[model samples]
Target: MSGKDTGHGTQRLALPGVFTAEQAAVTAAAIAGIQRADGAIPWFRGHHLDPWDHIEAAMALDAAGDHRRAAAAYHWLARHQLPDGSWYAAYADGDATRPTDRGKETNFCAYVAAGVLHHYLATGDEEFRERMWPVVYAAVEFVLELQREGGEIGWRRDPDGSACDGALLTGCSSIHQALRCALALAELRDDPQPDWELATGRLGHALRHHPECFLDKSSYSMDWYYPVLAGALRGAAGRARIEDRWPEFVVEGLGVRCVSTNPWVTGGESAELALALWAVGDSERAARVLRWIGHLRAPDGLYWTGYVYADEAIWPRERTAWTAGSVLLAVAALTGDEATGAVFGGAGLPRGLEAEECCDRS
Candidate 1:
């Protein structure tokens, strides 16, 4: 398309009521501006880096054709990966070599696969893919080590290396998608990982049939929509999941609430839910979700994290790289960006294993 949105032969991510080409580039530029020299994108300059959100910002860079910056971000991950194939939970933005938090989150560990796959799809960088395959493979193995007998991943590996008790619905759902992305990488390398396939099926089964097992976070909007967004629930099941929680989480002229309890609606959750809605074939509502969050976009092209409608204020008072990244990605999806659509829409993503094929027998 137009401007810097050339990665993957994608059309300019201009939605009718959402973003024009130049405006979309502005948003991408905002994220690029905040990125550090080492390619780490913290929540804001002062905030610490977390692996999952960091990868999300990197993917957004690739979407906008800032491929070099995106490559540097991935390389940062490679340099910092721990011996166990996991990254420490938080790295100080000022000095990434210093970890502020040492706990390794399972979902955070798994998401490198999704980011690697998305970047490769966008740029078709064979060298990058080759470099990243082992990183993804090791990360997947590390995450699977925490997979419970019931197929849900444990929340995190503590600094002492013990598995933390309990599975998170949102986190596991994200991991479900990551496992599939990892499988795609494995397949491309001509090395099939049947264990990952089985793990994917079991995890999907747990999400679809055994929701009671995950930590009860039903009050959060991410718990409501992440399964669909991550492709763990699809078809009629996915559509029904969206409808069931729509009234509780959606603010009419604003965006999706961060949690059901607050009047606070967040850009990241709202855009992710839009991607989820698009996956479920609800394009009309999906587009509306993006348009509703227009108020959150600042004059500088960065989006505020969330708004407090009850007080009519932008709470937390930060315009974050991840929020802008989520907005860019959702816009790209709605406007027919091929790479964005393929990754989130499950077009070219490898279908791991059917639930019946793997889980029923277990």
Candidate 2:
């Protein structure tokens, strides 16, 4: 399907009997509404411009047939990126903003490479790929510099060049996927990538076997499923890890929680869980995860930030761009649909040594 073809896009992937055509139209319109005229997408209604969340919402826009806007959003990131291959933690509208003088976040910085790669794939724009390569290369270098002794990546870099000691399993896992995508892009363009290969392998090894080396944020849904979803975990062991935590983190028809005990279920986590479940060959379970969040949809096709457990009303009571994007991605995965094949289509799992082979073999 061409990028211009809107008929088979995200609109059609909505849950059966769940979202109507009118609802999907509202959702698409809502996404478009958050997009700035300059092509940047904000996370919420007003001036909330976060890079990671913005890229995520842009991906959804591409899925919904807004490639021009998605490309513009990427261009905006390129324009704003620091020379050291990082962005501030946050940005205020029409002004450069930063919480600290920090250079870049490991997770947030790594994510844009995937977004660029996705844009290239969806649109097949060679010029865009060429323009984006420098950004991808520089960002990967920044991430590699922060890698710790045991192969795990640090969380973020302070402006003074100091690193956060604790690593997050979820963050590293996402970076692993980004690294692979970067490597793939490098190879596609016939560029040399020996360093990328080595770094990617090391990071993948850390994710597969060295959870102890990272911060123990295992109580969260991201930590639970990111290994699988991020393409860092594979085979029998990967399957086992997901199965072990499945019951603990999932709350039946409600959705997945940010933390297992948080009593708040969110669209992003639920959709992410669906992607992870699909990776492990559990389409039935993946579909269930998607369905769990279907009811969270607002009349505008957007979703509330999260669902409150007590009243079951939407908590934060605000529609979120990323939340709607998450639902679109989950629905795409569940329905075997792809508005843009570039959007992380279940590329099996990461290649090379299994978790057991990496950790236990003599």
Which predicted model would earn the best TM-score? 1
TM-score of each: 0.95, 0.89
Model 2, residue pairs in steric clash: none
Best of the candidates, lDDT = 1
RMSD of each: 2.4, 3.3
lDDT of 2 at 319: 82
Question: Model 1 reaches what TM-score against the true structure?
Answer: 0.95
Clashing pairs in 1: none
Q: Residues 313-335, candidate 2, lDDT per residue (tens digit)?
A: 77877787888877666665566
Tens-place lDDT digits, model 1, residues 76-149: 88888888899999988725678899999999999999999888887788889999898998899999999888
